[model samples]
Target: MPLKYLTADQSRAARGLLNWSRVRLAARSNLGEATISDFENGHRIPSPRKLAAMRQAFERAGVVFTAGGPTLSNRSAGEGGVIGTQ
Candidate 1:
């Protein structure tokens, strides 16, 4: 599973919307700190669970996870390395 899409800005905005520090977000999402850090720094893609937690966190903050933002399905496709394969 390779990541297919993640504009740097979108990743950053997601972090902001979650209102979580990198460490805190990682802990809350039950992901490794390095993993979350990598995603924030555009060094690595997040797993489906991590992506879902991020979306949920954003939703809690009143941020709508819509087409304009990163989406669970998009992340899933990207992670599965099957973007456009359907």
Candidate 2:
């Protein structure tokens, strides 16, 4: 399945939904404050570690990240099943 990357706005919204302050996120994810600001402001791509940290933070806030595409499990039927659905 093709990966549907999140737009900067969406990313920022997700971060906001997780209630992560820029400083707190930077500290927890080991990212610089300016880097986090740029990412939130659509000026930069977050590093892998920062992405992972964002995912973890969202998880802690009960926000699930779902890919917007088909998965191997659902490829045969073309059903709109989630990638990691049990």
Q: Give the lDDT of residue 75 in candidate 1.
A: 34
**Cα deviation in Å at residue 2, candidate 2?**
7.4
Question: What is the per-residue lDDT of model 2 for residues 1-86, given as tens digits with 9 covering 90 to 100?
Answer: 11233335544555564456878766765667787789778787876656666545444444444644312233233222222211
Query: For all candidates, what are the clash counts?
Result: 0, 0
lDDT for position 67 in model 2:
49
For model 1, how does the per-residue alpha-carbon lDDT over 1-86 read when each residue is reduced to its tens digit? 32333333554565654445777766665677787678777797676767767545444444443443344343332131111211
The runs of at least 3 residues in candidate 2 whose Cα sits more than 4 Å from the true structure, single-residue gaps closed, are 1-7, 67-86
lDDT values, one for every candidate: 0.52, 0.53
Q: Which ten residues in a row have the lowest lDDT in candidate 1?
A: 77-86
* TM-score computed on alpha carbons, candidate 1: 0.52
